[model samples]
Target: MILLRNLVFALFFGIGSVVIVGLAPVSALFGQRAMIRHATAWTRFHHQLVRWVLGIRVAVEGERPSGPALYAAKHQAMWETLELQMRLDGAAMVLKRELADIPVWGWAALRYGAIPVDREASAAALRQMIKDARRARAQGRSVLIFPEGTRVAPGETPPLKPGFAGLYGALDMPCVPVATDSGRCWPRKGLKRPGVITLRYGAAVPPGLPRRDAEALIHAGINALERRA
Candidate 1:
């Protein structure tokens, strides 16, 4: 049954991506704001369609910080990627450079204003990321990133990567730590279970803290969710 649900969802996901991205140019003609709104609609559609089709409810706790803040979230599953956009009104996401290289999907992400970071080339990529992140901040959007760089299983806690701190210090924005248990249901691979996934946003970590201090604080904040789980 779970496999059947996932297969159906995958079908809709593919068709939806092609349709939305195909019509993206029409939105781009109006300008960046329109493009983001159009792209955001696609994300919201997926968020809703999942609940209606698969019965997976997304329960979000804590209010998202407004303005140009940095959101460092726990990477558990792909669900939070689009769900975060719905939560933050099409915020800019820091993703792998390869994702932006894909044909149609990549073009839409670039036009929609996602920050792509090259994980392999650490220094140069971080520099370019900060530059692009600042550009996104100037556009009045929040910066969303997974501090661990990749998704982890429910009980595993990985240290926050250097790029997260680099962006935190470089951008000099208030850092908001977020945690979620989407992996418990929608994992990185295999069957996805139908259940309510909780996304909890913790208090904001003030900017200008020492790297060690900020890392310690953010790690604790994100790990708190696992403790509760």
Candidate 2:
């Protein structure tokens, strides 16, 4: 079932994204913002369609931060990245430097204003990311990050690197921790499975906490998921 859906998605998204990207010039020539918006619309459509076709239901747990907050999520599947784009409008994601190497998808991400970061040189990169994130917040765009840094299977916890705390410490933004069992459905290395994926939003850690304290808060957030479940 998952293979069938993936084949269908490949047939559509592969052709569709190329054609959608080709629409860029229409806006460029016409001097309109429609090109970028159209691409986002297509991506949003792809996200919704995947959920529908693969029988994966997404459930949200917990509240959205009242103000612009840094979103730290568990990395699981590609769907998580795609759905995060649609889940929050104008949201900027902190993706790997590698993703920027992709052809059409990378260009589309740049067009949509997604922020890519170098996970390897994360310490030095944090400053620039802070600037980009703040700019996005000023533009009413949320910044979502995958704190775990890499995709891991569900029913397992990956040791998180200190990137989240390092970034948050410098910027001192309100950081929101979200836990999701998305690996159960759209796992990192398997065909899609039919199941409900839970996204549990936890408290927004206050700003100005020391780096160590901030790190603990984010770690505790994931631990909370285990306790609550």
Candidate that scores best on TM-score: 1
- Tens digits of per-residue lDDT, candidate 1, 1-229, equal 8788888988998898889988988888888789889978988889877897777997778876667799999989888898888787788999999999998778878888999988784788889999999999888889999999998999889998888989899888999999998888887878888999988888899999999999999998777779866
What is the overall TM-score of model 1 with all chains considered together? Answer: 0.95
Root-mean-square deviation of candidate 2: 2.8
Q: After superposition, how far is residue 159 of candidate 2 from its true place, in Å?
A: 3.3
TM-scores for candidates 1 onward, in order: 0.95, 0.85
**1-229: candidate 2 lDDT, tens digit per residue:** 6789877767887787687676655544543235346656776877766777777788888898766778887777777777766666546888887887788667656666667788675566876777777777777767888887888766567666766766686555788887877766776665777778877788889989877777778766754555534
Each model's lDDT comes to 0.87, 0.72
Q: List ranges where model 2 is wrong by over 4 Å.
A: 24-36, 223-229
